[model samples]
Target chain A: MIIIISFFSFILEYLFNYLLKKTLFLPLITLTTTVIVRPFFKKNNNLFYMFCFILGFLYDLIYTGNFFLSAGIYLIIGIIINLISTNMPNNIFTSIFKIICAVIIYRTLCFLFFYINGITIFSISNLFKSIYSSLLLNIIYGTLIYLILYLLSKKFNIKRID
Target chain B: MHKKEKNKRTIIILSSIILSIIIATIFIKKNFNIPSYGIKDGMMYVNNIITRIFGNKDYYKLEKENEKLKEELEQYKDYKSLNEELNNEILKLKETLSIEELISDREYAFGTVINRNFDYWQEKLIINIGKNKEIENNMAVISNGNLIGITDDVSINSSSVILLSNHKFPLNISVKIKIDDNYIYGILNNYNETTGTYEIIGVVDNIDIPQGSKVYTSGLSSTFPSGILIGNVEDVTTDNFDLSKVINVKSETNFDDISYVTVVKKGNK
Candidate 1:
């Protein structure tokens, strides 16, 4: 369980969370620190906010065709995900919601960017195809992510590092 | 007691992040067009190379076409003198032709239909020839004496050819009837999910041509050679309240049965 978690969190790129939003920050950050930098500090504050910058920057690069748009969004998402996760039950359900929101926020933002340019993101005939794909994809992948994280928590005796 | 407060704070942070992403998206749109990257470069070239090195299955189909062509060529060779005389007669009838001297002298490269991709939105096929075999874009694809379609795009080793039946190629087709030499033009297109069926939406008169009328490409344009076989015409009917005839075309080169084809390399280019 632990090995699979570490592998998925780090290696498998292009993990989707919502109908159209694909985010990689949670996996990359969680895996890198959990597998590589866990001993450096028993507790660290900077890790929580950093994911947002990375996520926003990456999204901006791919979606908005600019820099830092995704960085800022991700930075904010990271902070939010971290903060909610800290106070929540931290169960399978919590993780699922986390993923759903992460993807929804990302997709909505991507749509907004296109919407502002007077081009309709949802207006295109193919919008439903994209939306349908996202919905079906999120349920399957989100469940897999939940299981991997659950297994990791048990196997390596790894707690939530953050 | 303190944990509840933290949960509230977390919710607030999440909302703020979403709000900011929304605002930022609008700002970016006002500045630049939607920021999205295109497909990866070099993938097409690599796919072509891979298809070639692996030996395209469509090669079998093209080989079959080649065998048929060879028989036709052999038969023509036997009657070479008659062919020359017949060709001369046809040539004199249309002396002031649209073809330039060099293009008129182009030769057809042989290939085969290797694979077929069909859906409700797009229908496509693959051929065995590629850059390794000297194939290029917009070169007319043909059989013994019929038009198919032009190449979609070319790779170093293989080129993707779009059939005339594809929805992607929308242009006027000028078909001259074999009998009575009656000329009829129509909009010929392939629906997304149908194989071996293309429609002519604008037939002008009731086409009483019986089943199995041979269809040919009218080489009104440089895209196709004159008199290349397109398909067999079926379901010719005229509609009320509409000025044109509806045509159901059953193509001769069904992707299902195609094992060989010729990529007629016009002028060896």
Candidate 2:
């Protein structure tokens, strides 16, 4: 199920990028979907971690030139989200917040990766402009996804594993 | 005791994962020739199908117009005279040098763009032809006779091109501007994000480089052949700190609308 969700999310991302060329913000649907599905498999934490790593590896192989950077970042993020989600209440607002936080963290990591690779965009204003645009779109898209997931869970009566 | 054991196991797992990531990164960096042929082929196949189903109709009309214009330009009588004059000057220089001159033959492979990188900041595009078509790294990629980019990573059926507008490791091209009877040389580097143009730096302050003068690749590097049209000088400003001149170049290629490109493969001279 996680793999299927990630695959579809990747396709959606490709379509969005292909159609909307100039849009600064890109919603990371795959990572967000993985975070949303984590609660359903809380007991099997190792399997979840493995799934995150594999999904991230595949993403890197297809999209990026770097091999392990995405995989490592995703694994760490999955762990962080797993820890937070276990303590926090699973609701629409909190879920949306979590997705926003995840997107910020991912973008920050990407910025750091760019810096390390010596592709530093010198102006702080420019950096913030790109980040804020992307953040705004990610939040909007994330809210919609969260609402859909909330409705589906409620209708299907899916219980949390913990 | 149960909680303590679980915490210990969690810490061990986290540490191991970090260690594995470090090792993997190092390994991949050292052995960089991992050909992602299967993934690229799958992506190209899917993209081709999608584009065919929902392709832009206007691109075809533009391509036809571009071809027509090129044919018309080639038939101009003034262009023939200019070509003859340039060839005569080259022959005179060769005689003066008293050395054997060998012209490197270039092979062009035409390809269609398959995909573009997802990141907005990264200036990269994937083309359909790759190692299968003898396309290798550092080959010059031109669109409609204007320089666009250079091929970087190649798979079996696809190759990724790094554009000149890429902020990362700004591609340094040696360029020159002809002024009356002399040519002034400078290095083109560091794209100006605000102005959306490339700046030619390190030009001597004394040279009178005119606005609207053309910039061509000096062929200092083997990757790109000399005489390829890069851009035109839009504005020139003197650096306040240093006495050098900074010339702003307006690129010839419209990056947004590039559909087809010709990859030039020059034989060893």
Clashes of each: 38, 0
DockQ of each: 0.11, 0.29
The candidate maximizing DockQ is 2
Q: In model 2, what are the clashing residue pairs, if there are any?
A: none
Candidate 2 structure, TM-score to reference? 0.79
Q: Which stretches of candidate 1 lie over 4 Å from their true place?
A: A1-162, B1-106, B111-122, B126-136, B143-147, B180-187, B190-195, B205-207, B240-242, B256-260, B265-269
lDDT of each: 0.50, 0.72
Per-residue lDDT over A52-135 for candidate 2, one digit per residue giving the tens place of the 0 to 100 score: 887777777776656666777788788888888878877766776777777767667766655654545545565565556566
Q: Report residue B15 deviation for candidate 1 (angstroms).
A: 17
Q: What lDDT score goes with residue A13 in model 2?
A: 64
TM-score for each of the candidates? 0.44, 0.79
